[model samples]
Target: MANRTRTPNEGLARLLKQAKWSRSQFALVINRMGAEAGLGLRYDQSAVSHWVGGTVPNPPVRRLIVEAFSRKLHRTVTHAEAGLPLAAFDQAPPGVDTVEGIVDLGRADMDPSRRGVMAAAGLFSAGLAVPVFSAPAHATEASPVTPGKQTVRIGAGQVEAVRRMTDKIADILDELGGAHARPMAAAFLVNTVVPWLRAEASDTVKKDMWATAADLVYLTGWMAMYERDHGTAQDYYVKALKLAGRAEDHVTYCRTLRGMSLQASNLGYGPLALKLADSAAEAAPKAGPRLQAFLMGQQAHANSMVGDHRRARSLLAETEAALMKADNRRESIGGYNQSAYAFHVSHVLHEGKDLPGSISALQQALKVMPSNERQGRVHFYAVLAQRQLEYGHLEAACESWARFLEDYEHISSARGDEHFDTMRLRLKPFRKAQAVRQLSPRIADVALLKA
Candidate 1:
C-alpha cells in the first residue's frame, strides 16, 4: 500500500494532554460514550492515533469526543473549541435558550425536507447523559425580557386551561396513536403554549406555566418516538427536561429522563439505557408508589437488555411490590397499574430469553390492559405473535398476528408498520402453509395501503 499522508490535529492533541488521557484512554472513553448514545463503536488506540493524525471521526463520534472533554473539565466544550468544525445544527441550548431551540425544532419538524434530515440523524449519548443546568454560565442563565411587543398577560387560569387541554390530547394519543394526535399537539405548542410563555405573569404563575409546558412538550416527544422520529423525539425530550428544571418540578424532570431511557434502550444502547433509567430512579427516591413502580420496571427492562438476568428478575419483583403499595392517587399520577407492570415484566422476560415466560406475561397484560390503550394493545399482540413464532408454534403465531392486524389497520404508526414488515419477511418461508398463504395476501394489501 502507498504511504498515507498524515495531517496534524494540534487541537485534539492539546486537549488530550490537558485532560491527561493517553491515546488508548481517549479511545476507550469515546467508545463508552458511543455505547451510551446507542452506537456500537469499536475504535481502539489506533483510532485515537488516526485522530491525532488529522483524521476526523464520524459526526456522532466527534460529538462524543467533545462531550467527554466537557465532563472531564466540568464545563461546556464546543465543537470548534475541541478542534472540530461546527455542526450544521447548533448544539442544543439550556435554560432560556431552550425555548428558542424548541421553536426552531418545531419549525424544522414541520418542513418535510428538514424533518427528514432530523429523522436520519444518529443518537448522541452525551445529550442523554448531561443535565441542561450543567451548561456554562450564560447558557444556564434566565432569558432576558424583550420589549415593544404587545404584553400578553397570563395567569393561573390560563395555565390550568393549557394543562387540561394537554391531558385531553394525551388521552387521544393513548387511544389512537401519535399519527392521529402529533400534529394537533405540535400546533397547540406553537400557537397557544409558546405565546403564554412570552406573556407577562407573576413568578408563581410563570413557574406553573413552565411546568405545564414541560408536560405538553414531553407528550410530544413521546408521540414522536411512537412515530419513529427518534432525533426529533430526543430534541423534544431535552427541551422538556429544561422546562421542568426551570419550574423546579422534580417529578416531571424524572419522568422526562425516564422517557429518554426508554427510547435509548429500545434503540439497543443497553449501557446508556441503564444509566438513564438509574438516574431517573435516583432523582426521585421519594416519589409516589406508582411512579416508583414504573421507574423500577424500566430499570428491570434495562438490566435485561444488558444481560443482567438476576438483577432484572429482582427489579421485576421490586416493581410488583411497589405497584401493590399504590393507592388511587398514586395510580392516577403515575398512569400505571397492574397491566402496565405486566407489560414491563413481559419485556424483561423476553429480553432475558425466557420466551415461554414472556408469552404468559403478555397474556396477563392483555387481559388487564384497558381497551382505551389501543396502541399498546397492538404492540402486545404483535409481540405475542413474534414469541409464538420463535417457539415454533406456527399456527398459534398466525392467530396472534391476525389479531394484531385487526387492531393495526386502525392505527398509523411507523413502529406498527415496521412490525408488519418484519412479520411478512418471517412468514415468507411458511407460504405453503394454509394460514401463511391466507395471511400473505392480506399483509400485501396493508403494505400497499401504507405505500
Candidate 2:
C-alpha cells in the first residue's frame, strides 16, 4: 500500500442532505452492512461521524458504503457518495472563454493522482455556478462564417433546415467513419450548417436550429479530433456545448460533455474525464433511461483508465440497468448511440486487460453496429487486436490491425491515424514476425500517415 493515497469525500454531506440520511441513519446503514458481512462490528452515530470526519475505513467497508447507498437510492453512487473520497480538489470547471475546458480536461487526464481526487468528489459543482456565456456573441465584422461565407443569424426555418442537414451530415460522417468523413463533415458544417445556425431567425426557430447545429457541430468536432485536429476539435466541442445550451437541449448538452470526457480520457486526463462525465449525468438526471445510461457508461469508461475496476464494474451494471429500463421515448443523438454503449463497455474492458470480457462486450457492440460505420468498426477491430496482443496472438493482432487500417483508410481522420499508429507501436515487439512486418507496410500506406 505504499502508493496508497487517502482521499476525503466532500459530496458525502450533500448526498446525505439529498437523501435525508442523518448521522444515525448512515451509521445504521454501515452497521447493517457490517453485520451482513459477518463482521460483528458494532457501529453508531459517533462512529460514523468519526469515520466521516477524515478517517479512512478499510477497503471492504468503503465498497460496502458505496453499495449501501446505491441500494437505498436505487441508483449507482461512488465513494464520492459518502463525501470527497480524497483530500485534494480539482480546479473549478472551465469557463466558456474558448477551448479552456477542453485543455483543462486534457491536463487532468495526464495526472492519475488528480483523476483519483476528482472522482472522489463526484459532484457537478460546475453546473450549479453561472454558465460561462451570459449573452451569446455575434460574429465579428471581419470574421466571415468561413473565408467567403456570409454571416448567418439564428431563426425557426433555419433551425428546421439545420436539423435535416445535421441528420444528413451524421449519416455521411458515419459512412465515412474517421477517414473520408472528417473533412466532408467539417466542410458541410462550416460552410453550410453553422452559418445557417448563426443566421437570422426567431427565438423558437433559433432554439430548434441551435439544437440541430449543436449536434452537427459535435459530430464535426469528434470527426476533427479523429482526423487529429485536436485544437480545432476542442473549439468545435466548446462551441457545440454553447449552442446546445442556447437551444435548451439538455440531452445534447450532456452528450457533448461526454464527448469532451472521451477526448480527455483518450489524452490521459482521467480526473477531468470523470468530472465531465459527471457533469453530463447531472445535467439531465431526468433525461429518461437511455440518456442517463449513456452518461453512466461514459463515466465508467473514464473510471477504467485509472485501473478503478470496481467502480467501473459498478457503474456498468447501473448503466445496463438503466438502458434496460429505457422507455420508447428514445431521443437518440445519432444512429451509433445504441451500439456505442456496447463499444464503450468493450473498450473499458480492453483497457482493464480483461480479454475475455472485452471480447464478449465487443461482440455485442459489433452485433449492433453496421459494417459501414468505419470509424466505429476500426475501433472495434483495433481493440480486439489489443486483446489478441495480450494473449500473445501477434498474428491475430496483425490481422485485426490490417482490417482496422482498411476501414481507417476510408475516412479523412487524424485521430484514426493516431490510434492505428499507437497500436502499431504496441505491436512493435512482434515486428520481427513476418505477419506484423507484412501488415506494417499497408498501415504505413494509409493517407493520413503519408500526410
Candidate 3:
C-alpha cells in the first residue's frame, strides 16, 4: 500500500480566519477561557501553530478553544466540528455535562491532593462581566442520564430530607466555623447530593433537588472562603450559581453572586468586587428586606474597598434602612439580617480607616449576633482588638485579644490565623508598654503552638 499524508486541522484554522483572529489572538482567547475554567494554560502562537499543524490539544483545552470560538462568533461550537478530539464526557448532552461537572467537582473537593482543581478554582476578574441573572440554557429540559446506571427513584420527600439536613449543617457552620464543617459539607455533597442528582426523578422533584443542592453548594463555597481557599471557593460559588439558575431560584443565584463579590473584595480585587456587588443588587431588585440589606451592605463594602467613601457611606445608610424593613421570619436559605448589616458596617469603617467608628460598629455587630455564633464572636473580637490597638487603647486591645484567643482556640480558620499574625506584628511596636508586656507571653505561646 502507498503511504498516505495526514491532514491538518483546517476546520479550526478556517474558523479562526473567519473570526478575524490572528493565531496569537486565538491563542490568547483560548488561554483566557482556560483560566476562567480554572485551568492554567500558557499557550501562545506556537501552540496554535501546532494545532493548525494537526496536533490536537488536551480535552480541557479543546473545550476551551471551542468555547472561545463560540464566544467570538456568538454561536455554539462543538469539539468534533472544531476538528478536536472529543472529551470523554462530551458524548453526553448539555444537562448531563452539568451533572457530571458537579460530580467531578464534588469528588475533587473530597480529595485534598487534587490541587489542580483547587488552584484553578480562583475568581477570574472577567467573570464579573458575565451575566448570571438569566436562566441556564438547559434549565427547562430533563437531565440526561449517564449510560449504564440504574434508574434510581427520587422524590420530593427525599429532597425535603436533604433540605432539612442542609439546614442543620448550616447551623453547625454558623456556630462552629467552616474549618469544622467544610470537610463534612464536601463529604455530604459527594456522598449524598451527587447521587441524588444522578438518580431519576420527576421534573418537580428534580427542580426542588437542584434548589436544595444549590443551597448546600453555596454553603460549601462560603465555608471554603472562611478557610481562605479562594480558588476552591470561587469554583464552588460558580457551580452553585449554575445550579440556582437551573432551579430558577433567583434569590440563591443573586446571593451566590454577592458571595463572589464578598470574596473578591476581601482579596483586594476592588474593581471586580464592586462590579459583582452592583450586578448582584441589580439582579434581585425585588428581593426581600433581609436579602436586600445583605446585597446593599456588600455593595457598601465593595465601594469602601475601591476608595469610594461617599458611595460606601450612602449604601451603608441604605443597608440600615433595609434591615429595619426585614420581617421577623426565620432566616431563609441564604438570608442575612441586622447583625450581618452591622458587620458590613464595621468592614466599611475599618477599610476607610475610621478605627473608632469601626470598633463601635463591631460592638453593635457582636451585640446583635447570635450568642451561639462562636465563629462570628471570634471574628468580631479579632477585629475589635485590631481596631483598639490602632486607636492606641492598649489595655482595651489586650482585653479584646484575650477574648479573641479564648474563642479562636477552639476553631481552625485561616482568617483567624491571619488576624493573629497581624496582631502579633501590631503588638511588636508596643513591646515595652505595660499592657503589651502583660499580653506578650500569652500571644507568643499561642503563636508558638500554631507554628
Candidate 4:
C-alpha cells in the first residue's frame, strides 16, 4: 500500500474529525507533526484550503500525516488505510525520509499542550536514527509545477528522502550557536536558506522552507541587533515577517514583531514601540493563549519604555490576570512570565522618577531569572545600581556596580555592557568620591562597554 497511488486527505480529515478537533486544530496538529518530523512546515486556514483542493502531500509528508494520526489515536496506520496512492513511493524528495525539519519545524510543538505528545526518552532518539541524509534522490514530488514528459515524476519514496537534508540543516544550525555560532549562523542564513526559499520549489516544500527561513532570519536579526546593527536587525525582522506570513503562521509573526518592538523601545524609538505593541495586542485576541500572552507582555514593555507608568501598570495588571486565568499548557507562549515583565517595567519606573518601585521590581526580577545567564543578571544588577544611585545610596550603588562587572567579564554580550556603561555615565559625579575612587581600576577598562 505504501507503494500504491491514492488521494487520502479526506481519510485524514475524517480521522481528525473523530477526535473532535476543529479545522484549525487539525491543521495545527498536521503542521506540528510535519514540524516534529523536522520539516519546519506550518499550516493555517489557507493550508486547509490547499489540502481540500487535492494538494496532496508527497509520500514523505503523507507518511507524516499517517504518523500523526497513529500516535494520536494510539494505532498504527497503513498507507492504504490512509487512502494514499500506492505508487506514492516515488512522490517525495530525494533524501527526505528522515525528519530533520524538526529543528525549526518542531518549534510550534514547543507549546505546552503538545509537551506530552512525545516522551522525554524519545527526545534525542530521532536525532540518532537515519543516515542523516538517508533520503533518496529524484524526489521533487512536493514541487508545485506539473511534471512533463521530460520532467521525471517524483515518487512518494523519493519525496520522503529530502527530509534528511532539512534535518541536517537544522542540526548544523543548532551546533553553530555557541561561542562562534553567531557569524556562522548568519552566513548560513544569508548564503544558503535565503537563496533556497527564493528558488523554485513545490508549495508544500515552500511552506516548509519559509517556516525554516523565518526561524533563521529571526535568530540572525536577534544576534545582529545585540551587536548594535539596528538597521540590519530591522531588515531581518521584515524578511522574517514576510516569510512567516507566507507560511500563514500567526505566532511567528507575533514573535518577530515583539522582538523588534523590544529593540525599538531600547533604542529610544518609544513611540514606534508603542505603535507596534498596540498592533500586536490587537491582533493577539484571535490567537492561541500563549501567543496572546506573549503579545500582551511586549505591549507592557513598550508602554513602560515610553514612561507611561500608569498605562504600563494597567497593561501589566491585565497581563497578570490573563496569565492567571490561562491553563498551565498556555504558559509557554509568554515563556518567562510577569517576573521579567515586571522587572522591565520597574526599570522604566526607576528611569522615570519612581525610585522605590524600581528597586522593588529589580529585586523581584533577580529572584526569578536564572543565575547563570550572565547577561541578564548584569542588566538586573545595573538596574539595581541605578536605582540606588538615584536614591542617594552611594555606598550601595558602588557595591552593586562592582558586582555587575564580575558578570560582565564572563560574557561579551553587548546588552550587559550597555547597561553597565549607562551606569558608569550616570555615576560620573560621584567618581571622585572616596568609595568610587577606590574602584578606579575597574572604571578604567571602559572599552568593553558602550560609551
Candidate 5:
C-alpha cells in the first residue's frame, strides 16, 4: 500500500499563529467560551491539532470556534476564515408559526440550560431580512391550531392584562435595569401570553391579543439589546415582527422595525440600520406625530453613521418639527419625548464630528430626562464623562463620572458594569489630577461592592 498525505488547514494555522496562543492555551479558552454557550465542550490540544491538521468541525461547533477567535482577537471570524463548513444561519429559513415560534423562543429565553447558548452567544446578522408590511393575509396569518391541542378561550380583558404588564415591565427596566425585568417578561410570555395566543377568541379580540403580545415581546427584546445580549435580542425582535404582522397592527409592526433599526445602529451596521429605519417609516406613511419623531430620529442617526451629514441634518430638523406637533400623550411602548429627541440630536452631532455641539446636546438631554429614569441616567453619565475626557475637560468629566457611580451602584446590569470598568481605565492615567484624587476612594468602594 502507498503512503497518503494529509493537507493541513492553512487558514486555521495562520489564525493560531496570529493569536500567539499555544495549542493548549487555545483549547482552554475555547472550552470556557463553550461553557458560556452551554455547550460543555472538552477539547484539548490534541483536538485542536486535528482541526489544524484538516479535520472539519460540525457547523455549531465551528461557530463556537469562530466565536472564541472573535473574542480573542476582538473582531469577527467567519466559518470560511477557519476553513469550516458553512452554517444555515447564513441564509435564515422560515417555517414556524407565529404562536408556536413565540412559545419556543420565549421558553429558550427563560431557561438557563437553553438560554446559556442563546443569550451568551446571541447572533447579530448583518444580512437579516425585514418582513414586508403588505404581504397577503394568507401569507402572514397564524397557522390554524391542530385538533386536540388543549386551548382556552380569551377575551378583551386578557389583552388588556398583557398591555398593562408590558408597561409595568418597562417601568422596572427604567428603575432597576434589564437584569431585574427580563426574567419577569420571559415568565409572562411563557405562562400568560402563550395561553392567550392559543385560546379561542373573536377575530377582533384575537388580533388585539396578538398586537399586545407583540408589544411585550418587543419590549423584552429591547431590554435584551440594552443588556448587550444581541443574539437573544434579535430572536425576540423577529418574533415580535411576526406577531405584529399577523394582527395587521401596523403601529406595532413599525415600532418593532424601529427597535430593530436602533439595535442595528448601535452595533455599527449602518446600512442595515438605515434600511430597517426606512422600512419602519415607509410602512406607516400616515403615522401620528410622536411615532414619526420616533422613527425619524433613528433614521437620522443611521444617516449620520453612514456619512450623510446633509440628509442627517435635514432629518433632525423634521424630527424636531414633528415632535413639537405631537400631543402630550406619552406612549408607553414607543414613546418619544424631548429627552429622547435631544439624545438623538447628540447622536447625530457626535457622528457628524461636532463634539462640542454633541456635548451640549447631551447636556440638554440629561437636563430634561425624567428624574425616575435612573438606569438611563447611568448610561448617559458614563457617555458624558468619556466624551468630556475626550474634549480635555478633566474636572467636568470627573463630576460626570461621580454622577455615574452614584446610580451605577444601585443598578444590576452588564452594560453598567462595563461602563464602570471603562471609567476606571479612563481615570487610571490621570491619577495625579485633583479631580481624579477626589473620585478614587468612592471608585475603590464601588469596585469592592461590584466585586
Candidate 6:
C-alpha cells in the first residue's frame, strides 16, 4: 500500500492540468510508459483518482509518473514538482554524512533483498548533479561513527595494507575478471576498510585511510560498471566522491570523475561524458605525464563521440605525447598504457566511421596488451572480430573470434559472456566459410563449457 495524506496531491493535479491530461488519459500514459520499461503496470482512471486523493505511488511508479508527465509536457520534471517523495538512496546525500552514507550504502548493497530493491529502484541517474572537485578539506571526525562497534587504532601500515589489497584486487580483475574480483573488494570495504575509516588514528592517518578507501570504492564501482549493474555502480561512485572529498584527495577525486566520464561514454551520453572529462582535467593537478595521458585519453574518446573530431584528434596526440614521457609502471587507478591508448584510438576511429583504421588500432591494442590481462584480451578480441566481420574480412574475423574464444573460455566475466553469445550469433551465417567451419568445433566446446 502507498503512504497517504488527507489532503489531495495538488502538485500532481496542477501538472495534469498543465499537460491537459484527464485522469484516465494520464493513467493510460503512465501504464504505457511503464510497459515500455518492462513494468507490467495496469493503472486506470480509478488508480489515478486514488493517487490524486492523497496516495503516493511506489518509488518505481513515481518515476514512471515523472517520465509520463515529462514526455507529455516536453520538458524535464522533478519529484518536487510532482510532489513525490525521493527514494531512500536518493535521500542519502545532503542529509547524511559521508562515512555513514558509505557504510549504509555498502551494507544495503551487501544484502540480497536490499540490493535487488536498489537495482529495481532506478539508481542510475543521467542527470545526477556531480560534485565539484574543489571540495575544501573537512575534519575526519565529522563523519558519523557507528555506535557500539569497536574501533581499532590504525597507522601508515594499515594504509599501506589497503593499497596492497587494492593492487591485488586490480591484478585479480585483470587476470580473472571482475566476477572474481568485485566481491572481494566489497567484502574488504565492509568488513575491513570501513572499520579502519571509523577507527582511532592520527588526523593524518585517518585522511590517508579515507583516500585509500575512496580508491577501493572507486574500483568497486568500476567493476560494477563492467558487470552492467549501472545503478549499483552509481551508488558506489557517489560514495567514492564523498570519501575523496572528505580526504581532500584531488587525485582520487579526479580519478573518480574520470571513471564517471568513462561510464557516461559507455552509455552513449557523449556530451555528459565530455563535461565530466573536462571537469577532471580542469581540477587535476600536474601530477605527471601518466595522469595527463589518462585524463586526455578519455577526453579524446568523449569529444570524438560528440562529433568534435578536431578537438578529439588534438587531445589524442597530446595523450600519446604525454604517455611517451611517462614511466612504464602501471599508474594505479585504472592505469593508462599503450594498450589502453590503442583501444582509445580504436574508439576514436570507429566513431569517425573509419572501419579499417579502427580494425588496425584494435590489432595494435591486442599486440601490446600484457599477456596476463586475460579479462581485457577477451573484450579486445571480441570487438576486433566484430569490426573485422563488419569490414567484410570474413577469414580475418574468424581468426580474431578464435582468439576471443580462447581468452573468453578461461575468464568469468558478464561482458565476456555477452561477447561469447554475440560471436556465435554473428558467425551463424558464415558457417559455410572454411575458417568458420574450422573454428566450429572449438566454438561448440567453449559454448558447452559456458553452458
Tens digit of per-residue lDDT, candidate 1, span 178-274: 7767777777787677767756777778778888888989888888887788878988988888887777778888888888898988788888889
For model 5, how big is the CA root-mean-square deviation? 12.6
* Predicted candidate 6 versus true structure: per-residue lDDT over 1-451, tens digit per residue: 9955478899899999999999999988888777776788889999999988879888778867765775567544556668777557553223134554455556655554354576676457899998665456555553333223333688999999999999999999988888778778877887788667757787788788888999999998898788777888888888888788878898898899999999999899999999999999998876689889999999999999999989999999999999999998874576889999999999999999999999999999999998888998999999999999999999999999888888888887878988988988999998898998999999999989988
Writing each residue's lDDT as its tens digit, candidate 4 over 1-451 gives 4755434377656776766666687678777776655677777877765664556766656666655665566543434445554333255432122112212222322232332342231222111111111222232432222111222223333323333333443343223222233455544543445335334655566556655556666665565466455554565666566555556555566677777777777677777877777865664436655456567777877887777778877777776667666665412122445556667668567646778888888878877765444555676788788778878888888888888877766655556657766876887887788879876678677543424
lDDT-better candidate, 4 vs 5: 5
Instruction: List runs of model 3 lying over 4 Å from the truth.
Output: 1-91, 111-131, 136-142, 148-150, 330-333, 444-451
Q: Which has the higher TM-score value, candidate number 1 or candidate number 4?
A: 1
Reference-based TM-score of each model = 0.74, 0.61, 0.75, 0.56, 0.77, 0.77
Quantify all predictions' global Cα lDDT against the true fold.
Answer: 0.77, 0.63, 0.77, 0.57, 0.82, 0.82
Q: Which ten contiguous residues of candidate 5 have the minimum total lDDT?
A: 89-98
Kindly state the number of residue pairs that clash in model 4. 48
User: Model 2's lDDT to the true fold?
Assistant: 0.63
Candidate with better TM-score, 1 vs 2: 1
Residue-by-residue lDDT tens digits, candidate 5, 180-266: 888889889977887677667887887788889889999999988888888878888988888788777899889999999999998
Model 4 lDDT at residue 306: 75
lDDT of 3: 0.77
Lowest summed lDDT across 10 adjacent residues in model 2 is found at 141-150
Instruction: Give RMSD (Å) of candidate 6 vs. truth.
Output: 13.2
Give the alpha carbon lDDT tens digit for every residue of 1-451 in model 3.
Answer: 8756557998898898879999999888887776776777899999899999898777667767766775577544555557876566554444545554555566666765564557565544445444355454443353544323334788888898888888877778766667667777787886777767757787788888888888989888887887778877877888888778778788888898889988888788898889889988988857878888888999999999989999999999998898889887756356676777888988999889888888998889888877777877888898888788779798999899988887777766777888888888888888899888988888878877777
